[model samples]
Target: MNPILDAFWYILPAYFANSSPVVLGGGTPIDMGKKWRDGRRIFGDGKTWRGFFGGLAVGTSIGVVQHLILPSYYGSLRIAVEVAFLLSLGTLIGDLIGSFIKRRLNLPRGYPAVGLDQWGFLISALCFAYPVRTIPTGEVLFLLVVTPIIHWLANVFAYKMKWKSVPW
Candidate 1:
């Protein structure tokens, strides 16, 4: 496969993890409707249990299907599942961490934090996947360069579709 295509495939779990939340997330907030001493919502209403788990399920399901259809592409079924779970969980965690930091900075929910919104998931996914898989330098670079663009585009699409309140 082309290196670019390979990189995209490798990062699909993270992409799905990052994007699915906007569409699938709702219900109770992850912070359990709590607030900080500063009177800010802990993670805001955006970080929800439903979103977190739903994104994980969607991303991991995609990986499982990929593994079943193209086992050679991801080495093995077990490894693929591990990588998928790690990337998906990491993406959700990263988003939550970003929201936490935003709240600490007094930014309102859905406020644009530039790189934080774009790179947080990629950074966390890389960190989580590092223990399970060795990502080539080229692929890492490709992901870094491409993720923000893809994220921005996806957010725009979601906004236009009324799935998201903001197009970050």
Candidate 2:
């Protein structure tokens, strides 16, 4: 099996986990409309419990399907599910963290933050994936380089489709 292909396969959960929230967002903000000490919304309206859990479910479900249908490639059910959960969870956490940091910097919701927006979730997802699944060095490098472009392109597509407020 090609290691780069495996890396791409491994990060799918994180990819979906990061993107699903945009489509599945709204409702009560995770911060519940509270203001932080700095007079900023904790996570803003964009970060909602619905989007968070929904993204996790969507990403993990994709991983489960991949594991079930392609066991040889994805590995055992337990490991796949576990890693999927970790990756999904990590992805969401990373997004939340990014939002928090951006809020601290007074960046409004949907505003682009360059590297933080592009690589944060992927980095967090990789952190979770490292313990349970071994990603080849080449594949990790591949993901690091390709994911940002994919992220940017996806955002552009979403912006064109009116699903997102910004092109970034």
Cα deviation at 104, candidate 2, in Å, is: 0.6
In model 1, which runs have C-alpha deviations exceeding 4 angstroms?
none
lDDT of 1: 0.89
lDDT winner among the candidates? 1
Model 1, range 24-136, lDDT digits (tens) per residue? 99999999989988888889999999999999998888789889878998888888998999989988899999999999999988899999999998899889888888568
Q: Write the per-residue lDDT of candidate 2 for residues 12-112, one digit (tens) a residue.
A: 88999999988997888999999889999888989999999999999999889889878987558888888898999999999999999999999988898
lDDT of 1 at 66: 80
Q: After superposition, how far is residue 66 of candidate 2 from its true place, in Å?
A: 1.0
- Looking at candidate 1, what is the lDDT of residue 14? 86
Worst 10 residues of 2 by lDDT: 1-10
Superposed on all Cα atoms, model 1 deviates from the true structure by an RMSD in Å of 1.2
Supply candidate 1's per-residue lDDT for 69: 78
lDDT of 2: 0.88
> Cα lDDT of all candidates, in order?
0.89, 0.88
Q: With candidate 1 superimposed using the best TM-score fit, by how many Å does residue 151's alpha carbon deviate from the native? A: 0.6
